[model samples]
Target: MVTLFDLIVSGFVALVVLPLAVSSLVAGSPPPPPNMFLAKYYLAEPRLMLASNLFLLAVCATAIQRLATHFGVLSEPVSRSLDIWISVPFVVLLLAFLGLFIKAILTVRRANRAA
Candidate 1:
């Protein structure tokens, strides 16, 4: 029973999650760009980017774990609908991570299969 409040919470959480996730992913694995693009844009510090990327991964992992607790998927007593206030954001972020993971895996599979 997702209400307007739930929708709002989910949207905000997704917005935050996607940017951090995508930026970190890009910074970590910089694909070689074309002649013009390569020289123009490059990671300023690969080490820092890697560190920040690891930090983001840790934070997201903890968040998703908390979300699992909210879902009781990790084992806990299910509370009442009042938990929706918390569940909305947790579930949204968890789903976002799941979606990203799935997409990344699929992309890898496709590339592997192609090669």
Candidate 2:
């Protein structure tokens, strides 16, 4: 018999895994292809993906912090500083990813027109 905790853990795992799997499928191809258009695959969208992963990490950290708070534990002031540091990278990566996504779309469209 699965306890409530077991079910909750399974649900959390599914929530995390399903989106990643879907994103990979949507990406359609691996990164590092010789063709620029083909590189639009999930692997190639590193910046965007990294931002997403980092966001998830931040969420997990917040949850952990809350749990600690509930337990009357004090976290260091460093977590706020760490959050600021991570935000900078996330913004940079997100912008880079958006630029690449636009470029990839244009490249694909051009190829289709040429063919």
Candidate 3:
């Protein structure tokens, strides 16, 4: 049941993320293709992939903490540490995503100008 629920959640997230990603890529390109292969290249781009994974990791950590809390497994200290761990990755991923977005924007601008 849990596995099925997780699969559903993941599919929902993918449905959201992939279209947003494809649209971003398409908008950036002047002569965009009808369909971009975002999934094929998502993991191939190291900086973007790392940023995405870091964000996902932070989310998963929070979810796990919540589950643990529901099961009465989280003490005060454990909860505090989990929050710290979650925040660190969240901040790091935020910065990484910002940097990568800026870099991509610059690259796209350069391409537009060159064209």
Question: Which candidate has the highest lDDT of all?
Answer: 3
lDDT of 3 at 69: 55
> lDDT score of model 3?
0.60
- State the lDDT of candidate 1 residue by residue for 1-115, as single tens digits: 4456754555554457647766858765553344744222223222333433444554554455445555566554443343555556556655655555555556656766899
TM values, all candidates: 0.36, 0.44, 0.57
Prediction RMSDs, each to the true structure? 13.9, 8.6, 9.1
Candidate 1: residue 20 Cα off by (Å): 4.3
User: 1-115 in candidate 2: lDDT tens per residue?
Assistant: 3356754555564467546645754664234555655455434345545445545444444444434433456445655565576567656656666676676577667777899
Task: Give candidate 3 misplaced runs (Cα > 4 Å).
Answer: 1-34, 37-46
Q: Pick the candidate with the highest TM-score.
A: 3
Query: How far out, in Å, is residue 47 in model 2?
Result: 9.0
Model 3, 1-115: lDDT tens digits are: 2365765565555556545545554554232233665432333333665565556656556666655654578876888788897888778888887787566666666766899
Error of 2 at 4 (Å): 16
Candidate 1 deviant stretches above 4 angstroms: 1-23, 26-45, 76-115
